[model samples]
Every structure is written in structure tokens, then in C-alpha cells.
Target: MKRFSLNQATTRHWPMPDLVAGCVRAGVTGVGLWRENVQEYGVERSAALVRDAGLTVTSLCRGGFFQEPTWWDENRRAIDEAAALGAGTLVLVSGGLPPGSRDIDAARAHVGTAIGTLVPYALEAGVRLAIEPLHPMFSSDRCVVSTLKQALDLAAPYPHRAVGVAIDTYHLWWDDTVWEQIARAGREQRIACFQVADWLTPLPAGVLLGRGLPGTGCVELRRFREAVDAAGYAGPIEVEVFAEDVWSRPGDEVLAEALAGYRDHVAGPG
Candidate 1:
């Protein structure tokens, strides 16, 4: 439980103050925040609120979408926000192929180049860029980087402290090569963040919000946890579920379930 974190998206409708208070009441010391939520609540205010409550902002969720024309400016703002929140890592969901273009190779090349452009700014801000590889299902419009190898490849040009990869179990669990890539990430010192969400079948309409909480689906959560630990990662394990059902519950109820799931599944002894 010491390393567990509740990502805000897991309970999307929970108000920031309520979430912070609830986490404090539950004895949770870490949280992964979403930019939209922080912006709505006022970034500085949100930072102060969390800090005053003695919670660590685990990682800010998202500064990628490199396909946007305004990506450069937007990413810089995201880095600044992360810095303000005292988050050490900024998660990047590298946007997919540009409109009407199918040249995946070129799109991926562009992502690496784009990150290179932001490395200096990110380093100066004291925030690490964590490239997250979404599942292949989102390859066309969400993220072109569909595997850990591709994410690591993109991070290769930058120093590990300036850029790294986010290992989310929900996305990488299907790849047989992930274990090997994870070891490589550890050796390269590029495992910047670790998020967990179980995979449920009969996926919901959009599929993006179909993730299950730990122990609620088929993923080998504990194995993934053990793998990252073996690979030398010592960061918080963020539970980032995105299901509507999970989000509909009260904040405290959802948090309790998340903690229990993490204990019984992700961090449990076999």
C-alpha cells in the first residue's frame, strides 16, 4: 500500500477537494492527476491543496498528442503544470497518424523528433517525459506507439531523466516481448511510470473506457508488478481504471475498492 496511487481518471467525477480529503482519510499518499481536472480546479490551487494534505502528485496524465498543430506550446504548458504540481513525470500518449495519412512509420518518426524538441524544456522544468504506448486498438487515432519497444525506441535519443516510457499493464500485457522490453527499460533507466488496469472482454463501445479495476478481469496484475519490481522500478503503482461503472460509484467507495483490489491482486503474494 505504501507505493499505491489513485489516478484521478479512475473516478472521473470526483471533485478534487473531495478526492484529496478522501485519499487522506483512506491513508493514501499518492495520486496521479489529469490536466483537465487540474486546470478546472486551478493548477496552483490544486497543487497547494494536495501538498497541504500531504499527498504526492504521482504523475501528470498527459502531454503528448504530437499530431496536433499546437503540440509544442501545449506540451510546454503541460511540463510547466507538472513542475507546479511537483510531479516528477509527465505522461505522454503520443498521438496517432495525422488526418488522412496512413504512413505509420513516418508518424512514429515524427513523434521521436517531436520529443527531441521538448527534451530541453522538460529537463529544465525538472519533469520527465513518459511516453505511453496505448493498445494497438488505438493505433489509428490515439497512439501510434503500440508496444514497449516502440516507446523505448522513441526515448533512446534523450537522456533517461529527460525522457522515458510509461508501462501500463492494460496496454502492454498482450505482447510477449514486453517482459524483455521491460528488462531493457530497467537497464536503460527508462521506466518512468507504472500504471495498472485489468483487461475486460466484450469491451465497451469506445473501448477506451473499458478497463477493469485490478482483480476484476483477466490480467496477471501481480506478475506485472513483480516484473517491474524485478526490472528495478521503485516508483508508485498507479491504478488507472477507466470504466463507467467504476466511475459512477461514490469517491470513497471506489477508492476503497481500488485499494482492496490492489492488495488482493496487484501487490499480493502468490
Candidate 2:
């Protein structure tokens, strides 16, 4: 469990201080936070809360929506927030196609260029931009970058330390080529963040809150973990489920179950 981290979204309703305390009580020393939550709690105060509790902010969830007019400014502020919280990685969810537009190719190209534009700022902030390719189900409305290969390709033009791909099992486990892409990411030194969540059946209507906890669905959890490990990734394995069932329970209980899942399925007999 040394590398296990609790992604805040798994317990969305938990307050920042309570979440920090919950992590401490559960022996979880790392977390992945959302931008809105940090902002609501006061970024510096959130940073202090986590730091004083001896927990590390593994990555900040999201700073991309390239199609938006304000993307540049928004991402700059997100990078600053990440730096303030001592989070080394900023996950980018390259948004879906611009409304009513069918030009997928153009959208993707723009994302790459936008990322290129932000490379200098990211480097200056001492933050790595991690491109997270959401599942293809989200390709139409959530993320245009929907494959590990695509994410890697987008990150290729930038310095490895400046831009990289985030490997989230929930978003990528279905792709057969992911293992090889993971290897490619390693060779390129572009594997910045690794997140874990199970794929559940009868996905909820919006598909945003349907993620299962580790080992709850068909995904071969350990396979993905091993692939990332073989890809030279030795960082926090953030358990980032977004199920309402998981969130409605007590955070500590959920944390315990998440740890058990990580140990049983992801860590694998260690």
C-alpha cells in the first residue's frame, strides 16, 4: 500500500479537513484533488491542511478544455494552484468537440497545439501536464483524446518532463494496445500519473458517476498495474472511483475498502 493514494472524488462529499484526517487515520498518505474542491476550501488552506497532516497531493484533476475561450488563463491558474499545493502533476482532460461540431481531427489537433502553447508556463510553474485520455464513450462529449496512443502522441512534441500522459485504468483498460503504449510512454519518459478504477456494468445515464471501485468489475486490475510498473512508473496509484454508492458511505469505510481492493487486486500478493 506504499504507493496507494485516495483520489478525493471517490468520496466527493467529504470536507477537506475531514478528508485529510480520514487519510491520516486510514494510513493513506497521498491524495488526488479536484480544482473546484481546492478552490472552495481555499487553495492555500487546502495545501496547509494536507501538508500539516503529512499527506502528499499526488496530482490535481484537470486543467484542460482547450476549446474554451478562457482555457489559457484557466490552465495557468490551475498550474499555479497545483504548485501552491505542492502537487507535481496537473491532469488535463482535453475536452470533447466544440459544441455542434463534428471535426474530431481538428479538435484533436487544437488540443495538441494548445498543450504546446502551455508548455512554457507549465515548466515555469514546476508542474507536469498529464494528458488523461478518457474512455471513447466520453470522446463525443467529455474528452477528444480517448486512447493512450492519442495521449502519448499529443505529449510527444513536448519535453518529457513538461508534458506526459496519465494512465487511468478506468478510462483505458479496454484498449488492447494500452500495454504497448504504456511501454512507449516509459521509453519516452511520459508516464506522469497512474489512476485506478474498475469498469462497471449498466453504466449510469451520464456515465460520469458510474465507475466501480477496484476489483468490482471486469477490468484486469493487476495487469494494468503491472504494465505501468513495467513502464518504469513508481508513483502514487490513485484509486479514483466516482460511484454514488461508494460516495454515500462513510469516507473511512470507503477508504478501507479501497485499500483492500488495491492490496488484493492491484498490489497482488505483495
Top TM-score hit: 1
Q: For candidate 2, write residues 1-270 as lDDT tens digits.
A: 899999999999999999999999988899999999999999999999999999999999989999888999999999999999999999999998898899999999999999999999999999999999998988877799999999999999899999999999988888989888999999999999999999889888758888998889888899988988888999999999998889899999999999999999999853
Each prediction's whole-model lDDT (CA): 0.96, 0.93
Model 1, C-alpha of 38: deviation from truth (Å): 0.2
* Model 2 stretches astray by more than 4 angstroms: none
Task: Give the distance in Å from residue 72's predicted Cα in candidate 1 to where it truly belongs.
Answer: 0.4
Q: In model 1, where is the ten-residue run with the lowest total lDDT?
A: 201-210
Clashes of 1: 0
